[model samples]
Target: MYALIVIISIIFFISCLLFLDYQLGKRNHIKNLRFLDFEPTTGDYNLYTNGDQLFTDLFDDLRHAKKQINVMFFIVKDDDISHELLELLKKKAQEGLRVRLMVDRIGSFRINKATVKQLEQAGIEFTFSSTPKFPFLYYRIQRRNHRKITIIDDEIGYVGGFNMGQEYLGRDAELGNWRDYHLRLIGDVVKDLQITFFDDWYLNTGESYDHIPEPTSEGSKEVEITSTDGGQLEDVFMTLIQQAQDEIFIGTPYFIPSERLMKALLSAMDRGVDVKVIVPMKADHLFVKEAGLPYLSRVRKAGGEVYFFDLGFYHAKVIIIDQELCDIGTANFDRRSLFLNKEVNTLIFNKRFVMDLRLAYLRDVQDSQPFDDHYTQLFNLGTKIRIGLAYLVRPLL
Candidate 1:
């Protein structure tokens, strides 16, 4: 009995430690917040669509880099674009370009040892996130560096849902299609993204940068950085969504936003704001779809517009408020993105960018199927019950 009590006590102690650590860590993170300095800078910021177009723009910006090129991604596959990018990096490195690359271990499984060796041979610096034990610290690693950031000369930056792979370049013969949203910001926001990359690099390499550069765009950018854990801007995002006065428009592939976000949407509708949401007709993850449907009732009742895009897969995470503020990044509307996955998004407040992003959203709407009144009739009682159960676990998803 004493042995059992001791064992139970040990278990209880570990649980309490983890809980306290998690909470205390979050508070510490809040104190050292990143978004407190987000203000717009001067530059020609724009909203871009499609993987190929985004890559083209990124490569163009990279070519214009005078000092450094840093990239932190989750996947780096050996497809057509990946190979081409590697070749270009090699050429640029031969020209003495300071190039650094990092990929997540789980996200880049298809990238074998040979490709890594090639990058090394080309004098490119590389790092891997989440090493498993044995020689590595094995398993139990949950937090992923899911941030998508690319900084060139510490001047131009790119962030969004696009990951490294054949699909991003739209050259995936297996799937035959890849749809995503990546933004190009030419301002001080790039500096914040650069800092994010530096933090990840230091996490694995134990090295620090001498001087983190600032955004060089002409005007200012009112952007905020949010995370799933400590230094969380979940409340910040929630506040922004709830505060929408005229119209609230969002496009997300996965639509499992937290209850707070859902309530904000419903409240927006209640106040007679035109609330609009665009989600994939067929999501890459099915359970997320199951979890998202139940929220539609309140949304529809509040007179919101829900749209379902039908072409290929609509994998864009975007939020536009009153056609003034726009958000684009890897964070989906789901809890996984909010509290599980490492996501990065940028909020562009310029009216021109908003108009352009709204046009892009409307262009996507052309290929979309509107989620109208028929949805409530589309699913039966059994489905609703299961989805409700699925939603209960949203925070941990």
Candidate 2:
């Protein structure tokens, strides 16, 4: 019994030490790789607000795709956009386009394999990313390819928080007023997106970037691809959050920011910079909503203003600073988005995009509702206590 107890204690001590070492290594890695090399003096970039025109552009790129079409998404539901895009993809595949797609085994949960089998039968290659379809064992399979990305003909790329969903496009009656931003990328940066796509594709299909992403003289002069976070890579978005100066404005449907981000925001506020945040009045996730309230309350007390868009559930993720730096992609502020989910975000240091985003801020402000402490007044002590405790595990959200 004594020997067994000692062995157990030894194992526990080693585990704790390993975890601490991992955390320290992660911190150092983040410090080293988070800030991507963006030439502040390079490129004239444009930003897109609505999905209609962006979808048209995406379609145009697909129509032009001759050699390859690579796409990877967390979720591909049976929405109008998905169907239309799939039909277009099928047509291209029929026309001898080397079309390939990767869907998350975890996120493409509700979607049936039969839905995509037709494309496979039509010669379009398809694969699933880290799919776990078990019972209690499935819960442990938490890491996911949460990125929503599409690369057309290896030239044009798309990334943002807007998944191929009706709610994201704000067309469905159920989602009357969701707001999101996606970049229609056409540049060398598309290579980064393609690299990301290839990485996910190979994780499932064993195909390299050479097989999926063909080199071309054609690249987007406007922007380049920057990563948010990959499995063990530093979260570039978090680094960007820390780089805020003069002004900081964020619009994310899920607003559960990490403690590091929260501290940065509060510190920025403390510096007297005008900071404004917008989130959904009604998030699609219930536990997230409950968890987010306490943070908002804390933020409000810290001289920050929180606006909740009541028109509908807004799924947009944007962060603009000083009308100079802007990023629009499918990343949210929460831990699931930042650390666990396979998310992507681009950094655009273009004056034009930032200026236009300022305008978007105006439109979003017009449509959003303000959140006050009044909503929490009805909550009793027990509920408040639960919310406070829920935040302790925010790192795992």
Name the best candidate (by lDDT): 1
lDDT of 1 at 225: 47
- Write model 1 residue lDDT over 190-210, tens digit each, in one string: 677777778778767888978
Error of 2 at 13 (Å): 22
lDDT of 2 by residue, 131-203 (tens): 6543323222555677888877666777876666666567777657656677776656766777777776766
Alpha carbon deviation, residue 165, candidate 2 (Å): 2.6
For all candidates in order, the CA lDDT equals: 0.72, 0.70
Q: What C-alpha lDDT, on a 0 to 100 scale, does residue 261 get in candidate 2?
A: 73
Q: Residue 358 of candidate 2: its Cα lDDT?
A: 81
lDDT score, residue 37, model 1?
Answer: 42
The residue-level lDDT of candidate 2 at 390 comes to 69
Alpha-carbon deviation at 341 in model 2, angstroms: 1.4
Question: What is the Cα-based TM-score of model 1?
Answer: 0.82
Give the lowest summed-lDDT range of ten residues in model 1.
133-142
